[model samples]
Target: MLYWALVFFVVALIAGVMGFGGIASASAGVAQILFFLFLILFVVAVVMRLARGGAR
Candidate 1:
C-alpha cells in the first residue's frame, strides 16, 4: 500500500514535470489518499501487535 502511494507520488512528479496538469493533479490526489490510508492501516497493525504482547 505504501509502495503504491510512493509509485503514484513519483508518477505525479514526473507528470507535473512533463506539464501534464490534469494527470499530475489526479495522481497526486490518489497518492495523498493512499498515503493516508496506508498510515492508518500501519497504525492499526502496530496497535494490534502491541495488544498481542508484541509477539513474533
Candidate 2:
C-alpha cells in the first residue's frame, strides 16, 4: 500500500513536469488518499499488536 502511494506520487510528479495538469492532480489525490490509508492501517496494526502483548 505504501509502495502504491509512492508509485502514484512519482506518476504525479512526472505528469506535473509534463504539464498534464488534470492527470497530475488526479494522481496526486490518489497518492494522498493511499498514504493516509496506509498510515491508518499501520497505526491500527501497531495498536493491535501492543494490545496482544507484543507476541509477534
Best-performing candidate as measured by lDDT: 2
Reference-based lDDT, residue 6, model 2: 100
lDDT by residue for model 2 over 1-56, one digit each (tens)? 99999999999999999999999999999999999999999999999999989965
Report the alpha-carbon TM-score of model 1 versus the true structure: 0.91
The total number of steric clashes, by the backbone 3 Å criterion, in model 2 comes to: 0
Error at 1, model 2, angstroms: 0.3
The candidate that achieves the highest TM-score relative to the unseen native structure: 2
TM-score for predicted model 2 compared with the true structure: 0.96
For candidate 1, lDDT tens digit of each residue in 9-54? 9999999999999999999999999999999999999999999999
lDDT of 2: 0.99
Q: What residue pairs clash in candidate 1, if any at all?
A: none
Candidate 1 residue 49 Cα shift, in angstroms, is: 0.8
